[model samples]
Target: MLLRTERQPSAKRSSGRDTTEKPTRGADVMGKGSVLIFEQDKIVRDVVSSTLARAGLEVHPAAELDAALQAFESGKLDAVILGAASAGDGASELIHAASRVSLEVIVLSSSPTIEEAVAFVKAGASDYLAHPARSPELLGRIERILERRRAREDLRSTRQENLKRHGVASLIGSSPAMQRVLNLVDCITDNHDATVLILGESGTGKDLIAKMIHWSGPRAEGPYMNVTCTTLRDTLLESELFGHERGAFTDAKTQKKGLVELADGGTLFLDEIGDMSLAIQSRLLRFLEERAFRRVGGQADLRVNVRVIAATNRNLEEMVARGEFREDLYFRLNVIPIVMPPLRSRKGDVPLLVRHFMNVFHRELHKPVLEIEPALMGQLEAYNWPGNVRELRNLVERAMVLSTTEVLWSVVRRRSRPEAPSEASFRLPPGGVDFDVLEKDLLSQALEAARGHQARAGELLGLNRDQVRYRMLKYGLNSPAPARGGLALRV
Candidate 1:
């Protein structure tokens, strides 16, 4: 007959077994997720419970089926370990019950067999462990399960945060041109499979719109991958988009999954798609048409569900006319077209954007809030922002960094009289100059003038920081390290 004893403070078991063994290293790091042990054998149940309890798990041990089910239903559990002998005929039923609630279940059997393991696994058991379960193995499996649960929780939390951060409400514009873009986004947020093409000049927030669609849409929980087509050449870009098998090329050492495969059930934002070579364009078109693609060296046509969103500052229609871009691919991507209005065209929104960015910079830089000068606001609104919203944002950040008082008087006074150079300022040489050399020389001089500050260098030219960096990289010009105790401005 079994005798039940009251729970003790020490590691002494009611089954007369000593469970006072020291827990292995890293055992206490098993996290706070709870585990349920359902075992009929009093000795096994007591031992397993003690092991897990020592490992820092909130373990609930039960000798009866009814008691186990009661505890499982009453509390939240990350995993449930069942003894096959104790469960007997009800093993499958219990597995189904736990699985229905999405709980991880592991079956423990004394006389293990492939048939029984397969049956239990088919019945929704996460794993099967042989009898006399070793403490290390048991704890290792439980730790892995808890680790996966934690990762999934983290992903869910991130998805919720992205939804909040990139939602339609964060778009921050109500002008008629922006209203039209918002309406299009609202209509397509529910359509997860449609291809979207965003067209706008550089720095017009095309990337922002793509993110808004992904984070606010039905597939918000899935991954969002952004690839700049201009950054890679044809062969490299092809392998990047379609993956490659081992020995596919000189540098192909191991099998790799591409962005398209990793972005399965999600969105893949291809920026600067106009720069993609014809070879890559052909492959991309085929994937769009068939929803399947072969890896660089693999013969299998793997399929994935990915929403392609292509954005470019260049005019694809003109490129098609010039045979620079594929007409078929352009049509496929332009199914749901979105044209972002230039910031100059929406000059009425300048005041709103200025104030919004000022607040954003205030919080980011931890600076005291400064009142916007009326004259500065007038100058900003009247000026043509060739670099669009990005330039405006950079200007605000720069001004905030340079401000010393509660008012933006000094920066406003300096900005009021803009000294923009005209086209006539640059004279063409009698012998036409090498454009690349001229560009590199100008970039070098600007960097020197700004004291190696990329953003300030960009301000000297009409380019944004990213454009400056890209050109600098193209010209193999490395920026100098920032000096200590220098003003830290946003890039």
Candidate 2:
């Protein structure tokens, strides 16, 4: 019973094509979906029918509310176009009847006032349009409504499929850190339109977290669009987010709808927003404040309803202090901040994640059940995961694809060691080496080579995890290391 409106329609286009013409397009004659049109006035009915038919919709014109209700009860109609001006006292009844069938109802009136339109919307009209309906605008509104309905249908099906594929669980973790993340997700399910900021290191599943929030919210039926901020230049990114009008710039041939407009009534995920330039950040801030923007080089302001969800790996607080990021924009986007804990910080979930990946890859590769060697599991649990979950998934996938044996130890054992150094010998010139600096540099290299796994780093230096931990603390390097003896990796 929600309501939406585009604008008051006009009968003539700038090109002077009569909005009432029966479209000659072959596609229009063979329209794909049926629309039930109810209008007592013959002229208005013909005009509305012609416009709908031209948009490739099959129109069933009815001269009375009873006929329209009968057609609606036939259950073949995708939508209903009601001429409220002609229906008189029966307009509300027809709207209610259509809503009962879950059919999208669009109300048409000869002279619709604000109060009347609001009344019709409250009576269950999905959209309200006043005569004479412009052909392009009317067609566009109908198509948009249909598109949103289809998107909702698709979302439901996809959710069901995901439930099956994901073992009826969206996020997997047993640790208290992970439990907190789940709690945060649960808390945000009902707050569909709030701007959300997701902070996480690369490969910690920020994208997945964003999707979870969108799908769990009330606007799940609406579109979910994402823009990767770091991949495109500032200008290109702006064009992508706020499309340019034809002839706006060089190579601009036609007008395009931006992601914000396209994601109406849905969520727009801005991935890696920290990478956006200051100019783009200001533009985004304006859109958030006003809920409207003009296309690049276009004069008219276009309004759209879209919820913003932003994600980034960078530290915005530090960036703000350093004058690299806008402080005001950060506050606007940080309305509801959800930080994703890095995989290393949730070491207790490593085994669970490994099993999940193993099962997924095994099924995908059509391989038998994977056998984990205890030593290999121990090594995996003890190592630090710099790349987070993504790296772990890649590791499991690579092992599944390359190794013939069911046991994964031999396939992945080599990765546990730090990469070998170059063959070049180091020699001091006239100056003596600074031992403290040299030691810190070696520690950094070993940590990097081991992919931040302190235990493996210590192994490279012929020291234990404890010794590596001590050196890291001495150097002011903070990274999680394997606990005393580390968690036991199951066979």
TM-score of each candidate structure, all chains considered together = 0.74, 0.60
- Tens-digit lDDT string for candidate 1 (245-343): 999999999999999999999999999998888989999999999999999999899999999999998889999999999999999999999999999
How far is 59's C-alpha from truth in model 2 (Å)? 20
Residue-wise lDDT of candidate 2 within 1-491, one digit each (tens)? 32334455444546665544544444543357778888888888887787777667889999977788789767788788888777789987888888787788888777777888888888888888866666665676677666766676787898666444432156878989888988888888788778999998777888888888777777776888999987799888998999889999898999988898899988899998988999999999999999988889899999988889999988999999989999999999999999999887988888898788878877888866567767767777776766678777877787778654333464246546565575555555455666666667777777877989986786566555645765786677786433333222222
List candidate 2 segments past 4 Å from native. 1-98, 101-155, 162-168, 403-491
The positional error of residue 308 in candidate 2, measured at the CA in angstroms, is 0.9
List candidate 1 stretches off by more than 4 Å: 1-19, 25-27, 40-43, 63-75, 85-93, 218-222, 243-257, 296-300, 404-491
Computed on alpha carbons, the lDDT of every model, listed in order, comes to: 0.83, 0.78
TM match of model 2 to true structure: 0.60
RMSD of each: 9.1, 11.8
State how far residue 147 of model 1 sits from its true place (Å).
Answer: 1.3
